[model samples]
Target: MHSSLNDHMTLLKEIAEFLNEETEMETMLQGALKKLLTRSVFASGWIFFIDGKGKHKLIAAENLPPALMENDCRSMKRGGCWCVSRYHNGELQKASNIIECQRIEQARRQSEKSSGEITHHATVPLQSGKEKFGLLNVATPNTIEYDQSELALLESIAFQIGSAIKRIHLTRQEQEIALVQERNRLARDLHDSVNQLLFSVTLTSRGAMEMTEDMELRDAFHDIHQLTQEALTEMRALIWQLRPKGLETGLLEGIKGYAEMLGIHVVTHVSGVIQLPSRIEETIFRIVQEGLNNIRKHAGTNQAELFLTVNSTDVLVILKDDGRGFHAGKIPGTLASVGMQSMRERAQAVEGTIEWISAPSEGTEVFVRIPY
Candidate 1:
């Protein structure tokens, strides 16, 4: 009993962690149902989420028979081992023996078999405010009894999941609003900054050409014009970074450019066909740039290698420098450094990842991966 209780506590803790981390309702519910199965409490469980059209869809399930997983939720009949009907029309429901629950009379009637038994199920109606969100159903051979502690844990998970879903929905809305505002702000700033500065420099150069008789001064004016153009280029890059979802530039262009850089000899080997979204392209380029620059600035190694390979469903980008590598744990979290934090955030935003493979004598390596 002691061991079992400890295991149960651990499961609840894990459930709480998952609820806290999961922002999407479908994902949270799906994860909760699965976590519950980790213990012997519920032999099997599945979650059905109501869709926008008021249709109940079994979006996720745990401990489902392998055969049933491939098919639609509606296909499962009363004999199904574990199924949760996310029906919000009712309140907290507990059926010791699903076979005894008269609620599934239709399933009994539909089956012309020797035994007309409804599976034992315990369902807790999930609700957020007045609206019914979904159902969490677990099925077992016998009356699956849950005490106050168990029910409380499940209810707590339900509440946490509900809150997370709510928070995510609000966050999504706020982000959308912020994006619109940011777009307008960037537009205004672009006009006031880069465009104006470039236009003034161009006109000034023209005026100087027409009025100045000294060739040396004219040359100097041309130099100023060149420098202003370079600044304009940087401005364009900044704007590009601000709105990086533009995948049109392609990863090929970025890699080729990196190869041309003098200090960072990014020996690259790319094969097959690969494509990425604009956000991904920009992130890879920046990560590569930062990694190489770090090596140049910190690592005393003279060599670096960059490799790219594309496969169905995902793309991989690797950049490594054969210089002294520092311990990843020892690294400080400060923007004052280089691009470490930016690289991490960018990878996470796309559901991708980066690994820093360097320690002491080992060279530094930055790896990036993203779903295609």
Candidate 2:
């Protein structure tokens, strides 16, 4: 009995340390579940994170038999099982024996043999205080029941997981708040100092050009005025990127405003209503910004076309320009020096794909597809 208690204590200590060190939500959950199964009697374990809505996501899973593992764990990813239904209805409150695994039962019905050699499992509601997150499930091959001591151990581990989740969430919120504050501060400083100086220079240069009578002096003033105007436009675009002030209104309008600031005449055709998550919206906006900047600098064209198509599965964005397109082989050194690589990286960050299509004198087209 003493040895068993010591083992449980050791397991709990290890789990607590692991959870405390992990700041990423998915990593923490997956690692905790793996550790729990390796140290305990459970042969397999999985975590389900269900929101206020009935939608469920399989966050982590381990050591699944062929039936459950088939078709990319299709059975686990879909349908509401008994425990999830109970969770939605406020009935599952603590660690208890779930009479039968609904997923396994369904798999068994379709298979000739037992699915995972398992029929029942134990589930504990992962919660902190009055707030509930989801469920943690564990099972052994052919296990049908769990004793009070086992249920109590599961509950303790569940509590640790829940607390860790809350801590990670709160930390992320604080970091995001700090980041926004910093961005806004920088935007204000740039607007007040550099932005104003560029505007003043533009006005002074234009006035000097108008006042001058000598051709050479007038030409010099004209060049200064044009340079200052371009500088102001670039500064405004940078400020907009830093703060993204009008993104709350709509992403298309935000993109248009950024393009206009860069002195590009953009004609946009949007197929569907533009509603996207903030991260997606930001990624798309940055890509579009980069595309327009390229059109302004290298494409040798002041006009561009943007086509956006939103469907149930994915979003498609096409930016096209009828400008002096360069040789395809030479584009690596040309566009890569600009923000082409940065645009690709941004698209990859959102699990999307980006491609460039261009040829000499034919023009350039940027294609981006992202699934939500």
lDDT of 2 by residue, 102-211 (tens): 99888777666447688888999898888888999998997899888788889999999999989987899899889989999999999999999999999999999999
Worst 10 residues of 1 by lDDT: 77-86
Q: After superposition, which runs of candidate 2 have C-alpha atoms over 4 Å from their true positions?
A: 1-14, 48-135, 142-145, 210-217, 326-338
Model 2 lDDT, residue 77, Cα: 91
User: If scored against the real structure, what TM-score would every candidate get?
Assistant: 0.42, 0.76
lDDT of 1 by residue, 113-205 (tens): 322122446555555665555556566544436565566556655565556666777788898679857975896699687768887997798
lDDT of each: 0.62, 0.87
Best by lDDT: 2
Query: By TM-score, who's the top model here?
Result: 2
* Clashing pairs in model 2, backbone N/Cα/C closer than 3 A: none
